[model samples]
Target: MSELIARYFDRLAGREDAVLTDLSGGLRRSVTGRDLPDLTDRVAGWLAAQGVQRGDRVVAVFDNRLEAALLLLAALRHGITLCLQPANAEAQALADLAAGLGARAIISAATPCPEGATPLTLEAAAASPAHPAPDLAPQTPFTLTFTSGSTGAPKGILHAAESFLGCAAAFNRQTGIGAGDRFLNVMPMYYMAGIFNGLLAPLAAGASVVIDAAFGTPTALRFWPRVAEEGITALWLSPTMLSLVMRLDRGDKVLPAGFRRLFVGTGAMAARDAQAFLDSYGMAPLQSYGLSELLYISVDDPGQPHFGSVGRPLDGVRVHLDADGRLGFSTPHAFLGYLVEGALIPPEPVFATSDLGALEDGILSILGRSDDIILRGGVNVNPIEIERALAPLFKGRGFCVTGLPDATLGQKVVLVFEGATARPEDDEIWARARQIVAQGPGRAQLDARAQIAALPLGPTGKIRRAALRETLAAAEGAA
Candidate 1:
């Protein structure tokens, strides 16, 4: 077992009855530390009985449910290779992914397995008779997850016990999230934002997590109230979810009372949204920055939050910025590499991300993605500059700006609104947007406008700008 998991079991040595997790929403169960040794043993032995020996991969399709968490811990304990995919995804697509993994078995009742592949539902796997478990050493290849596939097809990210646990430990030590704190996690378990930040970090801290499988707009509406009722001390949310909750909050003030932490990540939080959260709760949401490959690079100190910043670097993380503001980082805990077609593809020597950001007084602020910067009329126009200027015109509803191919200017700036309602007054709204930009300091110009019922967003709430850009370019070409 990894040292981290061993230490976790050590922490529960005398406190076996202590609750480790409270699961609700889709599945309801509360597991105490006492359940660990026996539960994990059962899971491992069952797989062993099914001929899933060490180094053999198993694909587990799950949400933020208890089964997934137990299975991960069990897999890690026995050193079985496990690939986690979200259960909420399309069944056939997930089946295809599972098949591509060449996994020994597919673990899901909801998803159908590809022909000639073995299927092991969670219920059956847990109930199987115990057998001898094969134990692989700590640094061996373990969990496999995929990238968001926003820019292209999802790439499988391979990680070992050392890389995963080391990063989890750093988050716990830096963020000081542990023991007495109970987390409310609405994020999907399959994503890094949800699994690493929301699950593993808290677990490493000896803190209990409340997994909400039914989290959505309705849940977000009652978010604060629910937190208050459950005695939940900390919570995790994406900026997109924050924006939605802010819109639906009804301005009915509710004191946080005892809720000490509100962690935001997965995307850059707009300044207005950050301010709005503080204005409502009297506590600023602690912003952190990292990627699936890097685990976590930086996290805000809960004691001192500098609004509009993702905050300082975590321990052992080195960050640098290019002259043009593109961000790069070197971390001790990067994932092994991408696993493709039975071959391991190592990571690039230099870890420069496509994100554009800045560091001021050692605090990092993500300006936007490199693609978010628009080039029009031989001038670099920031879409954020245009969006901020027009916030009032849209009354802060929801929107974004980007540059598209133009016959005259090389790139024509365009506006994308979230809703597709075609109002008769759209022409006036477009004219007003133009006037707003005309008066802004950047000399940015608005050329056209369109509305989409929903923006193309990654699971973690980050807008898929590259995908959006493609769609817009296609539309422009058709026009």
Candidate 2:
């Protein structure tokens, strides 16, 4: 694969004046072919000045701003490991990350430096004149993204420059993005998919990107008007945001205004929901499965989406299932080993993802987390299959299915819903859910003794499965 960001720099080097907009107030910040080299050089110089040697970690904590992008590319060009944490992340979280990852320098919008590390102010760095690129290693860690760990603390997943470039290549092959296309950076820079597709992929193809300050339903609703006015060609969204738009009364009026392709990832997307978005907006929702480890694994292409599947694996990426039925991959874009104890520990090249999946005639069918399966009285129950079934019945509704421990049957299936706009009777919904389960691919595995209940969700819109399970257990004990 090409040397990640440097290769992109070379790609942009040829073009003299290309429009690179910041979109803070819909302002356009032009980047010329000539000025491009200088900007990268200045970034390299800044890193060098801060003593950021090749392979060293440089943590960036900022919004999806232009300078944040510059810092990322520059750090990669210099072979410095780029650790991008969320701007809105709590101070405790940031401190924990810094300590855990051993971050030497930090690049942020903060005027003054943090307690221990070297701080590169966002305003100053962007204002600095362009200079020359620094010399560095080609096989160094280029980026770091934190995955939401079930244990409550997040783990930093590292990546090489080549891996990011490979991601760009996979995205380009899957999405067919090119020079005239424009992408809206709906996802945050902290997430691997967002950083690669929303930022790097667009720039690598010489396409323009609109960087938003934050991601939310209100912000996304505001974004639609801008997209229509600016003639945006593509967009990326999370399943949560998609659900929000579907819930909007004014959603129909704004969706079809502009946009050729809509790429959705970062969570499981039901096929029925994808169809709903397409039918309502007159645009196809390209669903994909991706993570911090392997950027983007699968994509639902415009012409040929496999409906329920996460589409097919992107170009230069191969998905395999082990004899044990766990999902593994051979991705061109593979990250360097994570930094554990002040040193980089290279990850195994062939990553066996914790996700469970199967390949039937080249199409990948993703199940829920491999170890998270519910065992109901010696029977196996996959939550995803249940969710997929329940999702369609309550179309445009928000719900999460999880496993609850039961004294009688090892575990019982439970359902937690956000709100019931389509308020069918519980008995009716339960009957439909049972019908769906009785006709599933692994129907024999269900014990026919599963139970479900509606539970509250956290502020982040994710179901607190553990809490719900605890509530169930407590209620069962009382009964």
lDDT of 1: 0.75
lDDT of 2 by residue, 1-479 (tens): 23455667777777665535566534555456546656766776677677665667767775666666667767766677777766665666667776677777666733233454455644456566554555555666787766545545455677777777778876787778887787777666666656776878887887777776556667756766767776788878777777885676364454634478888776777778777776777677887887677778888867877766888888878877888688888887777766555666666767887788888877777777766678887887778778777676666555666666767987777665544243546457667777777787877333333244445543224455566666656766877
All candidates' TM-scores?
0.91, 0.84
- CA lDDT, every prediction? 0.75, 0.68
Cα lDDT of model 1 by residue, 1-479, tens digit: 55666776555443554444544544466667766666667777777776777778887765666666767777777777778766665657756766787888767522344343345555665686654445457568778987767766778888887777788788878778778888888887777777776777777777777777535788778887777776788888888787787777874666556788888988877667778778877888899888878888888878888777898888888887889889998888887888878788888756889888888888888877786678788888888767766776776566778878887888888898787796676678789999888888887888878777777877877777778888878876787
Scored against the true structure, residue 272 in model 1 reaches a CA lDDT of 76
Candidate 2: global Cα-lDDT? 0.68
Lowest summed lDDT across 10 adjacent residues in model 1 is found at 109-118
Model 2 weakest 10-residue run by lDDT:
444-453
Task: Tell me how far candidate 2 lies from the true structure as C-alpha RMSD in angstroms.
Answer: 4.2
